[model samples]
Target: DELQAQKAAIQRETDLADESPEAQAIQEAKSEVDSNNKTSTTHIDSEKEPSAEEIAIAQTAVKAEARNHDLANPSASGEDTKSKSETETEKLAAAAKAKKDRINNNNEVASNTKNLMQEEAIKASNNSDVPNLVTNLNQSQASD
Candidate 1:
């Protein structure tokens, strides 16, 4: 009979996820006590979630750790420290810049490779064998 009543009460509430005061009253009333604890029936209260401040602190800590890691290993790419909700214009600009960057980067790599190959070819062509001065030295066991 108690279970049936609880079911009917929950049915009346309709949305269990609703956290408004009136909904909470309905939910609290429907909350059942453990069968083992027959001495008294107690409402089941869920553990409260972390506050905004707590969430901010956690976010800050994670950002700090990432900043430290980036600092320790300095790489070619630079990352932003702050998180922002990008506007539509900013997003489109970023996308365009990324495409332009890819093209430029490929060209830069090819140019660098060509310059390096030319320098190596020039060095190889200029090879004039200079005689080892040590070979012309006397090999006698006498004192210097």
Candidate 2:
């Protein structure tokens, strides 16, 4: 690094004295190189900064590309944060759905239990009394 910097410093000093033969040859070579570069590369745009309209058009093009992707895949409704392979979010959603289904199933089981146990009928028969139930069961057993 030091050697390259020293060389650059020496070259700068030589170039500052424009009367030197080395400096003249270097300037000529530099101009030739620049001209050759300009002719060889025609794909480069001369504009350094894009205008506001151009920037807007470029942004629109990008949005259209993303919109095209969404149109093709209707499931991708919102912003895509990851690929199909990176499915952590999808896994979480699936687990939540399964949990919801399980909860619904449990609710159905509870509803079925109300019919299976005949709790309402038993409660209606008892009428909040305890001694009556015991006596009834004892008499039913005695008769049997």
Candidate 3:
């Protein structure tokens, strides 16, 4: 433990000594690199900023190409629409199956509860004391 504490104190002193004028010069060089990076980024961003006429021309070209594309491949677009319809149909069928499964589960639960209630009622009827008591009374009278 003493050895570890001594090593830690020595490391702290070494770190403090390393933070000298030479290290400060290196840090200044790094700050200059950071500033140069910021200036370069601003230059790139300014170059990338589009003019109003260029933006308008690009927008017009995009709209015209889009119109031409729709005209050129009307059948493909129709097929895409048909495929979407089929997908919706399949989704509807899947939803119906899910609903049917839920209904079947509910029916099964209801049937099981009904059967359980009937079984309990039958058990209660069979285990009643009145019939056994009447039978015992008749047997005693007969013996007398």
Candidate 4:
């Protein structure tokens, strides 16, 4: 019974480990590598050498498969592929732009808040029956 319980515990742990994101990523990478190796290795019988036409056909098939793979995962191949330095530079630029945008947004919000508070204060001060001196003076001057 103890051995069975230990086995069950180990199996549960293994199941949990397999379900982890890191394990999943590793599995996916391994599968991709395996598939790539399988696609690249052309099987041949040692007794019979392949003809020129057969070799050409195999090469063509390999090329087609590679092209299809590139098409299916554009980031894995072609112009989208970037050097580490280039990728880091792009990331830094994006981060800087985001920070600048956030600062600008905050400044705008602060300015808006300040303007709103000033407007509210003015409205509150004008709540009395007395007319605002500056506004009345301006209106009187305009009438004159």
Candidate 5:
């Protein structure tokens, strides 16, 4: 009961302090914060992707490890026929390069498309005669 009474007294003092002139400044600042939150949006940064060279190196290492493991426990090997492991590694490397090239080409195309779109947007926005052009078209249609 004593602790409850003490808490009540402390709360009353806190309420009285909040009504003071200094606390009014804090309240005004808080209002500005609330209003700013309504108008402003937070931006998130995107994650960085690995470069082509790094991806290629990692792929190469994985292919080499697989080949080494196969050679250590060869099911069949002959002079006439290159080991399946060797052939597989070559295919994987080629496939990796092709995949990388395709990705690069796609990125280039996407960048060009984005640039063209931005340029078109800029041109459209810059054309101040749009309203006049529309009005003239309307007048011509009315006459016809």
Candidate 6:
């Protein structure tokens, strides 16, 4: 009786081990691995060398993407279109023109100021009521 009871208990323990959480997790992992292997094998079997037409189509797609990128960012593309020396030359020309304009403007301002001062001096001379120091000095010197 004791041996039979021990045998029954061992059988129950073995059954419980098969139903354990660890055993279920291991079973699930093996199923996933098998599924993945089958999928990869089928994918490999189905794959073939691309046709020339397919290759051309892929190349066209790549070219179109590149063109779109260039269109989207024009400044970032074709950076070598203008040579460095050409850009420098243009900048120098602009700076020279600006300097020339500033000098011309200053000359114009000075000429205008000189003309205004001459007009004021003439007005003062014509008005006898306003005392003119130079004319008075000249008269006094002539009398002496």
Question: TM-score: which candidate is best?
Answer: 4
lDDT, each prediction? 0.69, 0.78, 0.78, 0.83, 0.79, 0.81
**TM-score per candidate, in order?**
0.18, 0.21, 0.26, 0.31, 0.27, 0.28
Q: Candidate 1 residues 77-103, lDDT tens each?
A: 355542364566688899999987875
The parts of candidate 6 lying over 4 Å away from their true place are 1-4, 42-144
Q: How close is candidate 6 to the true structure, as a TM-score?
A: 0.28
- Writing each residue's lDDT as its tens digit, candidate 3 over 1-81 gives 999999999999879876988878888999999988887855556557788999999999998988877856657674466
Model 1 segments beyond 4 Å from truth? 1-46, 71-144
Error of 3 at 108 (Å): 99
| TM-score, model 3 to reference | 0.26
Over the full model, what C-alpha lDDT does candidate 4 score relative to the true structure? Answer: 0.83
Query: lDDT ranking from best to worst?
Result: 4, 6, 5, 2, 3, 1
- Sort by TM-score, top down from the best: 4, 6, 5, 3, 2, 1
Cα lDDT tens digits, model 5, 1-144, are: 999999999999999999999999999999999998877645333576778998999999988987876655566555646888999999999999998787668988767766777743343366655354344546667578
Tens digits of per-residue lDDT for model 4 on 1-144?
Answer: 999999999999999999999999999999999999888747655789889999999999998998877765645766667889999999999999998787668978767766777743344464557565565546668578
- Give Cα distance to truth, residue 17, candidate 1, Å: 62
lDDT of 2 by residue, 38-109 (tens): 888477578778889999999999889988777657676557657776698789899999987876679787
For residues 1-144, write the lDDT of model 6, one tens digit per residue. 999999999999988997999989988999999988887855554558888998999999988998877756656757647888999999999999998787667988768766777743343355558455565546667578
Residue 2 Cα positional deviation in candidate 4, in Å, after optimal superposition: 1.0
Evaluated at residue 142, the lDDT of candidate 1 is: 30
- Could you tell me the lDDT of residue 23 within candidate 3? 79
